[model samples]
Target: MNNQHETPEQKRERLRQEELKKNPIGTLKDGFNGNGNLADLVGSLGWKGTGILIVVLIVGYVFYKLFF
Candidate 1:
């Protein structure tokens, strides 16, 4: 039996395997699934929600300026 250390090619193959194990692409695909739902929720809100958000922001700014 040969108890030799790994060659350079073997080391590179091992490194590649380790990298794939650590960061699989499937996990990335799973991570972004919520973004689609968030987009759909925002789209359903329409302009009325946007207008309310703007008004709230303006009121918040006014309050901040008055208080500080």
Candidate 2:
């Protein structure tokens, strides 16, 4: 077995190549679509919906504090 240490530039290049493999089109395409329409399939009971719920809660709390 042999151990090798990569220079900073070499390590960065390797990481960039790995990122390209994971997202060739950059951020335009959603890679997780292989499973299906994640939103419809998983329903609205997920982090997406939960995030909206949290925003609403925060706004409501602010309004309550401001008005009453």
Candidate 3:
């Protein structure tokens, strides 16, 4: 085992290289291409629906407090 200490910049650059390798396109789009229907794409992801549900619940609670 080896204990190597790297500077902050060095560590950042190393992580950047790893991410570039994972995403060669070098963009934050998550590899989704254009021309695809936005609703279909979002609906395909289960977590997105759950997140929207949570937001709706929070807003409903806030509105309830404001009105009642």
**Leading candidate by TM-score:** 1
Model 2 vs. true fold: TM: 0.35
> In candidate 2, residue 36 scores what lDDT?
31
Q: What TM-score would each prediction reach against the true structure?
A: 0.38, 0.35, 0.34
> 5-48 in candidate 3: lDDT tens per residue?
88777887677556645654432344246543443334333466
- Model 1, span 1-68: residue lDDT tens: 13267888888766655644666453334334553343333333446865786799899999999999
Per-residue alpha-carbon lDDT of candidate 2 for residues 1-68, written as tens digits (9 for 90 to 100) = 11267877788767655665565443223334553344332232346755886799899999999999
Candidate lDDT values, in order: 0.57, 0.55, 0.58
Clashes of 1: 0
